[model samples]
Target: MFTLPHHIEFLSDRWVEEGRKFLVGEAPKIRERPAPAERLRGRPLSVSGRFTQAPPHMNLPRDVGCFSVHFDGEAFAVTTSFDPAADLVIEGDYQAALTGAQMVGIAAPGAFRTLRREIDHLYGPEALKVRGAIADPMALEVLSGLFDHLGRKTVENPDLAHRAARQGLSGKIREMEAQGYTIVENAITPEFADEARETILRTLSMHGHQTMNWMLYHGRALERLALNPSLMTLIDASLGRGAVIASLSCIRRGAGPGFIPIHTDYSHVPEPYPAFAMTGVGVWAFEDWTEASGPTVLVPGSHRARRHPRSSDDPGAGVPIVMPKGSVVFFTEGVWHWQGDRTEAGERVTLHSHFNRGILRSLEARRIDEQMIYRNPPRLGEMLGEDDWFEKTTAAGRDYMRFNYMRQLLAFNEAGKQAILAEPQAAAPTKSARRAVPA
Candidate 1:
């Protein structure tokens, strides 16, 4: 018992007809490659729902109708409706339906610029098929091939392997290389961990919410905790010669559906699933990570798995990262992981620092003003990205800065830096030069 606005159905008919022509190979090919409007030349769409549009941040509509149809590329007639008999049932805000409709090529362009920016981050080369499938039904086999090409699953990219091998790895580093992660027990002094724990708890009371970018707010103590020398060495070992901090935040586990779901932190970057660690995470435990306390879980050796875990897969295959307070866990970005469900009554807290290979973008926004940079120690300022602007602008400039910083940080000896600098550009394995390790 639902119907659409009269105008929406008429407009939908035009788009749907266009979609059908593209799918049937009847539409003429233009100079543009993979154009969505061109492909959906004659597809008919039918949806049933009544939705209200908000100025921004829309919600899902109730009841389904033709006007409620969203854009989806898998089929030529991409549609959505909650009319019980509709193809898809959206349960949230009507604005979400509008957004999805626009995303798949439905709806008008009222606020699509902001939505497109988010879409770019969500849909990369691997998932670009929605556009392709909508554009060319004949591209099914080609799309399959594209997905295969994107997954370069192997132990490690040899160039990064060579670089890591050259670091004169300690036993811990070697273990990390073999297992994809390593837990450094008692890496931090008890007194230091206690102080950091106190700081986090005090800050948590003021913030009320669980996780936050607590580093800047707490001042020098939190900064010192994040820049612990031993932890940085381990991080740099895997992140190659010039890794820098991308974000510094805290995650406090709470009792709910779980604070964070099981997932990899690797989707932020574009890629052909690099065989090395492009991003690394360092978690300094402020309290014990016990089974009851809902510790973080990691799938052993999954860092090399170029694909993400599907819903049907077994989550129990992962092992919890259990360690004492004051210990630290370091892991490569690609590893499939999620925070464990907290069955206990209280909460557990951990300070996390995400480090990225200098070439990648930072996870959080940062400003490198002179006053702020000069206030911190030179080494700390470097991690805070004081010199990042020069590295981000041009290719040659980035290389020059990377080499210089690596030399200063002692990421490599003088001879090692010289050897790396002399190599042909193609000889470097993946663009990300660090290897994967476990936590």
Candidate 2:
């Protein structure tokens, strides 16, 4: 009786063939509107204050923000509201801004900055109700909405979409400049990783997806995040289940790209569950994400920006991540980002994935009828692909096409992949890792 990793498994093509017998309806089409918060605000609510603090991961200066429990205490004005927690001390100064250990750039002052130089991203609730400490249904709803919205449109504000497209090759350059990424090890077993990769690639092939957006791993990638197990195990030993998947999937480099742009990753639903919510994203480069194969460029701390600025508009901050395979480039997803073109040649293989929990799929995207998927030009047989042909999923009893609990569960099963910093790991270490160490 071997214990299978939760939510993932391998299925024989024959077994999968038989499972597709009775088709389930496809998921509902999505609306291009803001977010799906309206649906989940049903739970009750309350907002309170305590002398607590955010998890260690969310404390990065650029990643930090000021929130007032009462408008009376400080003259400060926070752009948005976040979850209420105990032990969360409302700091009136910049000391909590950022610790030196969290700072990334060499040009920045000192060992590290105490506060974020600026606050760029803001997810204000159009209408929110903060109760005592019961959890605001509306805020939670907004968080869930942002999570889903950012999934499809990396740039939550589409106004920045086309601009972030970066030289029409997608925003790799800007992604590198604006946001950084991280690489973790042995987060997922090879067997589990293969399942995730196969699911994404197979899904893409079935869909006949090609071209710039052909990076199916972007929208459909994993959202669970893991630090160096040393980092996580060390932290978990301190916080227990309170440890959540803070950030995941911030870059994917390719070739022949140009232009740098802006964007953000929706992160209302952090990983592990209720305790880990409201964090951003991170990325790991498996192959060499170079100038040749457009690499994700980013604007430092741009997660606080209105949008990811173009490299053309702003210079210097833009660095193409020459993309050494083993380093972990950790950055906030809510920050601005884009990509650079492959000055050389050949494409790079980078995987940007993450893990999060508690955000529900919008009934807005719910597929009540199997016909929508069966008939959808974008989701037909080729897209959903040979559910009949090649292989099948053991994801039975779960709604593969519906916006039910399973979608997130499926995502969870694939979340928190050990950041792969080199070529696929072999039974024995490969030469690729001779230098794939994190900076």
- Residue-pair clashes per candidate, as listed? 33, 76
Please list the residue runs of candidate 1 whose C-alpha ends up more than 4 Å from where it truly belongs after superposition.
1-169, 270-272, 369-376, 388-439
Please tell me which predicted candidate would have the highest TM-score against the true structure.
1
Best by lDDT: 1
- The digit string of per-residue lDDT tens for model 1 on 1-439 reads 0001111211133333433444333445422455443344344332334433221111223222233333344443333323434343333223233223322111224323433433332222222112111233434322222212211110011122232332222444555555566676666556667878778878877879677873654754575566454455566566753457778888776765566777877864554468667888878877777777787788877776666667887887687787778778787847778887777787688888888876677777765655444333333554655433444556444544434544444433333333443443332222112222223
| TM-score for candidate 2, residues paired by index | 0.31
In candidate 2, what are the lDDT values of residues 1-439, reduced to their tens digit? 1111111111112212211211111113233332232233233222222212222222323433333322222121222233455222333112122111112222224311211211110011211122333244454443333222222211011111221121111222222222333223333334334444544455545665532222332321231113222222222111221223322222323345565444445434332223222233335454545555666665554444433344456644654554454333444434445666666654344444232222322211212234332212111111222121123345554324423322332333222121111113334322322222211
Instruction: In angstroms, give how far residue 342 of model 2 lies from its true place.
Output: 1.5
